[model samples]
Target: MKRTTLALLGLVSLAACAQAPQGAAADAAGSQAATAQAPAPAPKAAPRPDTPEGRALAALRELDPNIEPDRLRAAPIPGFREAIVSGQTLYVSDDGRYVFIPGVNGALFDIRQQKNLSEASLASLRRELLQEIPKSERIVFAPPDPKYTVTVFTDVECGYCRKLHQEIAEYNRQGIAIEYLAFPRMGLGSEDYRKMVAVWCAPDRRRALTDAKNDRPVPVRECKTTVNQQYALGQRVGLTGTPMILAPDGTQLGGYVPPRQLRERLDKLAQGGAGAGAP
Candidate 1:
């Protein structure tokens, strides 16, 4: 599995101040002074329909009509606008001349905050997208009172994935809900994909999932399931491996985390502290 990189630039606002004349110049400059003092015309409002944003959105739709343009807005970068298309964050040059996809090796950082601006934006977009997923499609293991929910993309055949599943009870006990989304690392048309479909088709999905993770036979079954859709979603979010944990705020934990440690990290996130662990 390969990880993708995304880049973002910082935003800075510039303000200009006009100084009024003083003393003799002040008296002679009365009329001119009023002109100078007159507040600069209110900064132009963001262009509306048929404007740059509209043009950019139209151009994008020409390529893919499914791309939602209503969310298009000026990005922190001066000449670009940000938009979410199919749950992925995309940057379009204001003139509709360029489109930036997440995952560039080099990234722009905020010197003052020492944070990766691009990743931060991507995280926000991911959180928003995840929230839109209906809970019915996910196989969730949650306590009655969950303090935080972590979404995980898992593959039955992956060793680390099984390890994480084995500890699901401990995670729930810690008040951390684990919502599972299938990611057949082997891709479609493989045994892993078939098994996932079977697990989802079972009458008792939770039991079937645990049994499969334990390497037990998951009586082959077939049904209309969102396994494939979930796989596509994982890719859209740049998933690189199984057992990929997504924190409540959309920060990726990268790999398997021990139950207790994972709980501590969730606590910090709940308290509005910086996320711990790597992407």
Candidate 2:
């Protein structure tokens, strides 16, 4: 009789469950179904070509999608927009109908000021870009208190680079700090590039760099280094060869200036209020 009662109770419980109103489980299933049926969020729409900014962006992206529109600004030339893409200065028509890449040593000369407007713009850009690199990444030779600092793009095997290094002490003596960044003229993954990597990876990077510049052997030590990055940066800043010396304001002081002359130039810039201090 107890078993029969227990079986009856179980049957009643089953009936109650089967007749139970749709609650949390049913609601959850329904919610899941609704969610599954929902449409995905739409992708951002492209800029409309009808607008000036849109047209400019479209033209710039057509050249390279990586070209940041924000980097572009009004060019010194009327009806043009200027930008630096992959280290090359570019001028695009405001209407997005044309793009102009200056050839080697190309500039927009302003006769009234007797200056290269493009170069001035480029100098400012280079200054901003160089500031992004930290001192830790560079092989530096500096006095205890430096009055001026210059960054040099150098190749391990370049003659002018070695010449400049030979006079590094003199530069420091003249209150100028020298920071060296690798720019392997032979390109990345080459023998020269490997040597620069070894120098950067050395326990004493400054000594290793000095030895390399002196044509002494730098010990082959395998380690990660900023050689490649520095090389890329060199290319971006219009470096055609090694020992490309730049003032604190990113003004190209040309290659391998005598220490005294470099100091004089720096002093002149400072006196002229062009800011020859490291940015």
Candidate 3:
């Protein structure tokens, strides 16, 4: 554990040492790792989520309070630790840096209705960050009142995305508020991705996005922002497709959900309530 702690510090120091790369080509590669600065430390013997190392350790400790924290050693992730306790991919803060905000792997479980515990915990936070779908970027179709909300990670080039897009009205009619976050499937270097950036950077982001989805061209321009950060956020939560929908309870819904069926799903979720048999 002592060694792990030291190693985690090393990673953090390295990150501080590494210079940010210049140019659009390099920015995409680094976007996945960009985050807010680590927070202030807690008093001695009291772990807090302000430090990367601290967050990693705290998460591990929370998982197994009885385990010997002394045995953990830092591995690869900066401000995070990888202890060999039982050989799991046990990640935690190297020094209690950042909270190991959990994401759900709901599709992996048998209880389709129930979200994972760790993931459910992160739902409220995710909701706060979810962007409202622009009326222009989307074909406006809203239900009388939305009982369920979802933030969709969308890509213009994806066929499934197009299929989901076609049902925009149907979903809105079901009282499901569908917000969108851009997630270009192709890597940053591809021509498709270049188009996506243009779509995001356009004076009329909504129209440009629509044009891109329709395979029309937009004038190329560059801006340094979180377009890819949004994509990385999706990836961090294991989003693999164009339309990765997140339900209000932090329940993850992948693939397409027609409006009527989606309403039913939301109804079930709302009725069941939070943490109902969550993993």
Candidate 4:
């Protein structure tokens, strides 16, 4: 959930914040202040296209076309959508005049709201695009001519991710080819980030990655790598942790799923049985 302030900030009425003048002077000042009327709120901003509301909505539509204007309504903030395009509740200004998109982490915002609406947006966006899959990033890790491929957004240092790595053979035994993409999780500054870049860019990425996962020492060589792109992909999908599974068809399964379950679900997705779980 995001809370946006729609009211014009500079136009706050004086009646809301006058302090007492203190003592006898304070008494007289209070009486004078009380007699003075507060200024009226400023006229709403001109809507663009039609008025402020239209402009604000146009801006939102620029983000995506699925926005239903009829579905648009006054938010707690007034002008913003009572809920944004993704059904994520957001606040808009009261006058259908202005809009703000708030940033939040956990439960600290003024409004109490469920988390990951932003994450959900990323998933929705991915669903609408990112359809063609790439091959260079994939490696056949399984037997019997693998029937499923899973794109894993992984960080080498992540614990559960390490656990998943340990089971790569098991997953393959079930005919799931594990394709890996780097999501360093610590951003690009960390050592793991650099190493993963070397792994992805290595002449034999499969060997480099497998060796790295098995704790084998690899000569670190770096070129411009897909590490950044992969991390961006992960973030755009709201990946807060590692070992995110992107099924062959792009449905996302976060965290760790056991090999048996992973194989079954992969088969299901391959057969067109999964929903839009991608992010």
lDDT of 4 by residue, 1-279 (tens): 121111111111222355545796767776886657767666544345655456556544433344443345555543445534333433444333333444432111121122224434454576543443356654435557887777787777788888998888898888788777788877887888887987877888878877777778778896866577777777775566788887644457557888888876666556544222321
| RMSD of each candidate relative to the true structure | 18.1, 26.4, 15.5, 13.6
Q: Model 4's lDDT to the true fold?
A: 0.59
> lDDT of all predictions, in order shown?
0.73, 0.73, 0.58, 0.59
**Candidate 1 lDDT, 1-279, residue by residue in tens:** 011211122111011122445775667666785677777655434446567687667545544554454467888878887876544566766666555655543333432243455556767887887765689989999999998889999998999999988888999898899999999999998999999999999999999999998889999998998888889888877687788899877877657998888988777656654435343
- Pairs with backbone N, CA or C atoms under 3 Å apart (clashes), candidate 1: 5-103, 5-104, 6-103
lDDT, residue 79, candidate 2:
84
Clashing pairs in 2: none
Which runs of model 3 end up more than 4 angstroms from their true locations?
Answer: 1-145, 273-279
Error of 2 at 263 (Å): 1.0
Q: How many pairs of residues collide in model 2? A: 0
* Model 1 accuracy (lDDT, Cα): 0.73
lDDT of 3 by residue, 75-141 (tens): 6766556554432234544543332322233211112232233455556556555433343443223
Whole-model lDDT, candidate 2?
0.73
Whichever of 2 and 3 has more lDDT, that candidate is 2
